[model samples]
Target: MCQPPAVALSLTVSVLAESESASAALVVPHSPVGHHTDLDALRAWAQHCDVVTFDHEHVPQEVLAALAADGVELHPSPDALVYAQDKLAMRERLTALGLPCPRWTRARTAEEVEAFAAEVGWPLVVKAPRGGYDGKGVQVCREPAEVEPWLSGVGEGGLADGLLLEEAVDFTRELSIMVGRSPSGQAAAWPVVETVQEGGINTEVLAPAPGLDPDLATSLTEGALRIAGELGVTGVMAVEVFEVTRVGPDGGTRAAYLVNELAMRPHNSGHWTIDGSVTSQFEQHLRAVLDLPLGDPSARDAWTASANVLGGDYAELYGTYKHLMARDPGLKIHLYGKGVRPGRKLGHVTVYGGRSGDLHSLEALRERARHAADYLQGVVTE
Candidate 1:
């Protein structure tokens, strides 16, 4: 999506939202996500921009500390994006950086969520540490009267300073690494995808994740480049892991990985690196927020699967685009021109090199990217 021989520019804050149909000399219009609390219109849109980024991480760390006190230039700064915009400050800074988290806490009473669910037991996981997404402020309580309407504020907001719980991980899937630092610290990683969630969004991904374990994909790309160099992160961070699978002590079978969420932008599990890597987590997040020099996230195929195209009851997705481009002429679809509801996310479909690219089978690249995303979400038709 960072197209053109890259000289980018598409800033949005949805001034009448028309999802990136670029060219109006490259769309601009700021102030919308959380309604930018005007600081001289974010310092006149960072004095006509030279560097300032974000496609989500709900900006507003005091409007990125008043555009870094007016000097602007924020590629992940804002204290490394408040650990991807607060989830109880990303589980207290990834459990004080020892990482491998998921047995968390922070209840604020329903008697501290029934004493942290009687010491972490009953179907835990509660969340809402500031504006949740996809799964919407999460929940899965299993009792404590379902966290009494988010601690009696009914629809969140009266969360009354409380909600974060955890301890539901039994994972054996959901991976995703994607790095790319820069702003001089230079970094780069990729290949470590597997996603595929459902009600909580993210429908499919797969990439270098089919049977991973090349030393656990080099320890999940060196722990996502050490959490993008201990959080000084510049651009493109992604990192949502949780692959667990235990049993050792000579009994055989082991693999562990945690750290479940964090995305400083350019995700959807690296959208299968656009067309399957060799550079493209949106051009390495525009060459690491314009610090330049960064590319080659490797994988130009051996398998690349993508798939997400949620919105349903198909509102004429170009009438099945000539039968999904004559039935997968090397499928690639993208779409996002918004306006469609039921479980939103309106586009995605990538499929590359399989069946002669020698099906490096993951169910043959997830049945050819879920049959071109279930025939562009009309949910199959031949």
Candidate 2:
């Protein structure tokens, strides 16, 4: 829920739903994260604003605290948001709550990392406890030497929460569930979606994860809702989970899931909900943030696949869409209206309601979404 370019669409959708003109103010941080945030200007702005919500998690907690002290209402208060802002806090809290998570520990020195690596075995994940997203502050270290550079930078104010080391999970697939909870305690969940990741960025999403076990799906959805309520999270939160396989003592493998991460705002995984669900995540977020009753997050399509359209060589996206619209009229395209930079997330496309069932029909939907995404990026000419 950080400052992704796609947040423009979420804001637009929310504004349109409320039939109100929303003002978007950009706060250019003087430095990356923390005190660099222009608190004085923000405080002045918040004085006139009714409710201040965030699109990204980079806002410093102190800033939020200062605003709250001034009585500026903020959704997903700093108390609940600390979990999303700091991986260490999230891991500690989730684990303490008996929620399933990868076995992890905080490391301030290379020795600590190596010690943990010995227990977890080689190939562990090292992450920045704060200010990390899209795999930027994360690293996979197979051995102690691989963690040297990052560890050297730890301690002091460099790595605010030090370094986080965890066992690199052997997951079957990535799954994400989106849920919205209001201050009134009303909560709703959408179908669990399988996420396709490329370069650590979510590349595509399959709504109602194809071939997902009903029991497993129910468990994930329920677990996500439980997380929101337990964490005191209001507004839409996407719980990213890792679906893993467990073998009982009888040598029978069983499917299970574990919490991997949490986003306290609309996430890329829920982009498909815009066109495929009864109520989109954007609108749901606004409702929850405003303390309104939650929306029904039911899917309107049997098979919906959302493909992220990355910035590519081509720039004439508007012209290319002419051919795309004529080709697949059902394709739902959402562009961020930002200048294209190679490999940057420009926007996403969603295709739903082909009446496709399970894996059989989902492939076509996936391909259609993929092709449209590629075409818009000028990766596919025909």
Candidate 3:
């Protein structure tokens, strides 16, 4: 039998749920919870934990490496995480591996970016080489003129340089596959999820996506697994993909999926797992990092979907949650403790129990999600 420690861990907003898990043991500063990014403070806090992981990709690799050097266990070692941290490096490595990816190039100057655009044509995608998350560092340029501002960067340190440009992918839709691997190299994967993006941000995710062909789902999962293995990822990873309709070499309609981005930890798209699958992403993350046996990633039902409530105005939303629950008591909600802005992920509403014949139409589900979102934004009252 093991006794619980007085304090178990220290974490920023990203690992709030993990910090609260009974298995991990909750630990916090003497002061109340708020944004605390001090490296020294983080190091001291992490030292007390059995192992350390991340909720975001923004942490400095050097800092993580230092922690590892000091005998602190950091999963998905800095070496592995670098691929997720640097956009150019990831694209270059994946390209080298002969993976299917959108045409992309790195630019150190505005002139170079313009040149790349000239070759790829207008309506391009521009991204920061580092420190960009959500929809922050991504820019869709219809012409060369729209490229310079994103190339300049945007943040507290002013515009960052060294950006990457990719040819806009004209795809049917986007999908995400979540892969989880243990430190021992044992791996597991969840259902391929169909992700709906609005304004460059993910607004909803459907598991065992409606009308998803089994072959396509198989291909997506295999691609996700291969990528995780190649990267030697030690924990959970979510691979964002683009499903494109294109002419095959034989010249006929064929469905193709291309890798879009990589996330090294639990992801928003996996939120549906809480109600839809036997093992949720958060629990799987803990198992992988702790070197414990992996759990079954099977779907609990035929289908499940999660809709995110973006923007601020939690007060109104909080007030209406009871009403929503009153109507659909089975709905599962996960709210993040963060200051919300327009298009920011504040919380999510998940609904399961859908099957092939009696499926909830996408629009109907979207309406329920929208009503909740509106209620949260104070646009609607109970």
Candidate that scores best on lDDT: 2
List where candidate 2 sits over 4 angstroms from the true fold: 1-36, 156-158
Specify the poorest-scoring 10-residue window by lDDT in model 2. 13-22
Model 2 pairs whose backbones collide: 2-56
Residues 65-95, candidate 2: write the lDDT tens digits: 9989999888888988999998899999899
Q: TM-score: which is higher, 1 or 3?
A: 3
The best-first sequence of candidates by lDDT reads: 2, 1, 3
Question: Which lDDT values do the candidates have, in the order given?
Answer: 0.77, 0.81, 0.74
Tens-place lDDT per residue, model 1, 55-140, is 67776688788788878888889899888877878778877878787788887777877777788788888888876777788888
Candidate 3: tens digits of C-alpha lDDT, residues 1-382: 0111121222221232323332223332222222224556566666667777777787776677777788888887787798888877889988998888999987767788778878888888888778778877788878766875665554423134367789999999999999899889889999888899887888888877677767888888888888888888888999998998879778887777888999898898888887778878877787788788888999887667688888755543466667778877777776665556676677788876644534555546656666665666666766
- How are the candidates ranked when ordered by TM-score, highest leading? 2, 3, 1
**Candidate that beats the other on lDDT, 1 or 2, i.e. the better one:** 2
Residue 161's lDDT within candidate 1 is: 56
Q: What alpha-carbon RMSD in Å does predicted model 1 have with respect to the real structure? A: 20.1
What's each prediction's clash count? 1, 1, 0
